[model samples]
Target: MEHKILGVIGGMGPKATSVFFDKVVEKTEAHKDQDHIDMVILNHATIPDRTSVILEKNEKMFITAIKKDIELLEAAKVDHIAIPCNTSHYFYEDLQKMTDIDIIHMVDETVKKIVETYGANCKVGIMATSGTISSGIYDKSATKFNIDLSVPNQTLQDQIMKIIYNDIKNDLTADTNEIEAIIHDFIFKQNCSCVILACTEFSCIKLSEEIQSYCIDAMDVLVERSIELSGKQLKSLQQNKSNAAII
Candidate 1:
């Protein structure tokens, strides 16, 4: 059987792109290499910083670069496209209009999963770039689903930006304390039922198991959707099926 092709528009930060690719491969349930999904990956590492473009209110350069990627994917005959960058979803509608093929909405899929897993009344905390937060991408989706949101204040948000850009993006070690403290506040103080690791950069780090329970990684959601949409079974799902049969 021919598996559907998945097009990836990546390199918002190179590490995040690598992790996303690894997750797709690791999570896919394939008996052999032939069973794996075919992919077209464009590591557009030089694409401008998404947060800066949104804050600067000048998106022409970012749009132009990504548009080319879309056209290329369309020509490649990809069944669907997955952009692992959460901040780039700020320009989602325009990006979608640029191609007939579907570009998986990472933000929307994350929010929907949160509601389905935790229920609509749950308060969600967002940990993302200033651009994604300021653009109201999560807020818009949460409101539509009738879920409450708890975002980091200016100071906390600044710390997150430093970790994302100053540290992770630069290949320096990050101080994971900032991430822990923010998650603590959201879950304990703000009474958020769950916190979203909304930025792809967060996926590149290791969070403690305790901290992870109260958080959802948006990248993981995107990965699951990408694999399924590309006509592959998730490894986790395949395992569950095997266990059920044994029972």
Candidate 2:
């Protein structure tokens, strides 16, 4: 069987990109080294910050950088691409137009999972970069899925931004206490059924047991979809190895 090459357009923040790639490797149902899916990762760390571009309304540099990455992946002959950064999906449509390669929609996939797991009435709280929230990418997906979405207020949003940029992005320890309090507010105050870690940087934070119960990491969803699209079985499916083989 011919397998598709999975392309990762990453390094929006270097650590998040690393985590996504690690999940891909860890979640593949591979018995040997060769059983793993074929992948090409373009860790283009030099790409300008998505939040800065979106907020400033000057997207030329960002667009140019992303287009170059896509071109590099296209030249590599990757069949599909996945971008791990939630904020960057604001340009997903435009990016798709620049290449023939298929790009997986992370926000759409994440929203679908919410609907599938909790039904249309589910209220999901979003933890993402200000750019992602302002871009309304998740909002659009929530509307499409007919699910209610909640976001932090301006004050809380600023704190979240600091955790993402000042802490996680800069290799400092994340403030788990603050994150937990936010999650608590989302669940108890906002009446959210679950929270989506829409920012890749949030993936770097260790979720406390209470928060872990209700939080969904968007990066994990993207990793799963990437594996599926690449023609590889999920590691979880290996529990039924014989059945998986038959399929």
Candidate 3:
């Protein structure tokens, strides 16, 4: 098979980008270095915080900067582009328009994965930043897949944001016990079939064994698709799931 190069538009949060890259390498079924997919990663960490831009309604600044990244990836002649940040996907359509190369739609693919795994009627819960929830990107994708979507209430949403920014982004340890409590509420109270960890920052935190069955990391979904799209084989499911194992 002719393998293709994967282009990563990263550094939305430096740690999460590193985690995504590490997951890709860990989850690819490769025995030697030569079997791995070739990659081009542009760590555009200086790009404006996605949540802030969306909340402040300053789309132009983010768009202007990301457009350049797209052009650079195109010039690099990559077969596909993957943006690991969930909130940045709020500009998915516009960014897709800027280049001929396909930019993997993390939100859309995540919704599709839910439908495929749990069935279309499964009630889904999203744990993402306020901007992602407000932008309605996951909601729109869920609607298309006929999957019902739910989100944390305001108080919990604020907690999620703080965990992403104040904790993980600041290089502090995430309170996984608190995070798991929220996940339990989604499952037992809100009746969510499975929760989608839609933020890349969450990808950097290892999930507990109890909630792993009830959650799907959107970043993991993106990593899997990126490998497949690059024409590389996926590691066995049991092995691939280890990358997101116990916090």
lDDT of residue 172 for candidate 2: 51
Of the two candidates 1 and 2, the one with more favorable lDDT, higher being better, is 1
> How many Å off is the CA of 169 in candidate 1?
0.9
The TM-score values for the models, in the order shown, are 0.94, 0.93, 0.96
TM-score of 1: 0.94
lDDT of 1 by residue, 28-77 (tens): 88889898889999999999889999999988889998888998998999
Pitting candidate 1 against candidate 3, the one with the higher TM-score is 3
- Candidate 3: which pairs clash? none
By lDDT rank, best first, the candidates go: 3, 1, 2
> For candidate 2, lDDT tens digit of each residue in 1-247?
4679999999888889998988788788889999898889999899999999999997788999888889889899999999999999999888989988889999999999999999997899999999999999999999999999997899999999998888889875788988888888899998999999999888777777678788888998999999999988888745544553554
Candidate 3 ranges beyond 4 A from true positions:
241-247
Cα deviation of 154, candidate 2, in Å: 0.5
Superposition error at 201 for model 2 (Å): 0.9
lDDT of 2: 0.89
* Whole-model Cα lDDT of every candidate shown, in order: 0.90, 0.89, 0.91
